[model samples]
Every structure is written in structure tokens, then in C-alpha cells.
Target: TGVSKGAMLSHKNVVSNVLQASGAYSPTLDDGAEFVVTALPLYHIFALTVNCLLFLHKGSKNLLITNPRDIPAFVGELRKYPFTVLTG
Candidate 1:
């Protein structure tokens, strides 16, 4: 058995964070033409908000790495795409 604790965030919190990120990053339509490669797991808040949500908001493509430990495969996958941004 295990113990667990949970926290909840309202829609406004999410939207506010997204908006703040957009303002900070200043992503434009040109970003939509690029791709974002993320080694961090999307289950984590930072990756979820910045790598996935932020790019999605900018209309950019997201290439998620299911297993970043596989060095060869990871490099191969990155080479396969003209990735513009890499986040770990």
C-alpha cells in the first residue's frame, strides 16, 4: 500500500499561467513552422505546461520522448525531425 496527496488548480490558474508564458516567450505564428522536442516526461508539471501546452498554444509540433534513456534511439528520433527547440 501507498499514501497519496492531491492538489487541484482551477481553469483560471492554467489559463493565467499559459498567458504569462506566452507573454514571456513571445511565441509567434512563425513558431508554428517549427517543432519542439522534449525529453522531460509530460506527466510532470513543467513539461506539461511549457513543453506541451505552451507549444500547443503556439500551434507548434510536439515530439515527446517516451524513453529518453535510449541514447541511440533518441538521437535517431531527433535526427528524423527538424526540431527547432529542445527541452529537458
Candidate 2:
């Protein structure tokens, strides 16, 4: 069976993770200019830390994909933003 893993993560931990990741990429990434495509749900830890908080902290706008399964619509949306970063 296939099912999403759901759990609660502490704010401190999530923030720490985001900060750590941001630090490493900050040197090469430009602020307020990056467009990030987040295909994974924000509730997921990976998306929450890297796609949302980390990128947002770096002043990047994230295109949250509510329904990633719709490839046609997702691809169409991509044309609207000049995405420099993508994560799923």
C-alpha cells in the first residue's frame, strides 16, 4: 500500500534544519530573485524545510504544487515563472 507519512516536527528542529541548509546554499544563491517549484506537500518535512522555509528565508518565491500529479497543468504553470530552483 502507498500512503503519505504524517507526523509532527518541532519548530526548533525545523528551523534549525532550514537554517543549516540555507547557510550552505546562500553563498551561490541570489536573494529575492529565485523562483522555487515545490511539488511536494509543505506538510512533508523535506518540503517544509527546503522548499518553503529555507527558500522563503532566502527571499525566494515558491510555486506550491497542490496537485503534483497533473503534469500538464504543472508544466503550464512553470511557464509563468522563471524558476531557478526546483524540488519535489
What tens digits encode model 1's per-residue C-alpha lDDT throughout 2-82? 898666978888888987988888744355776899999887888988898888988899898899999999999988999
Q: After superposition, how far is residue 33 of candidate 1 from its true place, in Å?
A: 2.0
C-alpha lDDT (0 to 100) for residue 72 of candidate 1: 100
lDDT of 2: 0.87
Q: How well is each residue in 1-82 modelled by candidate 2, as lDDT tens digits?
A: 6996666678888888888998899898999999999999887778878998988899988888789899999999988888
TM-score of every model versus the real structure: 0.84, 0.84
Least accurate stretch of 10 residues (summed lDDT) in model 1?
25-34
| Candidate 1 segments exceeding 4 Å error | 1-6, 27-29
Judged by lDDT against the true structure, how good is candidate 1?
0.85
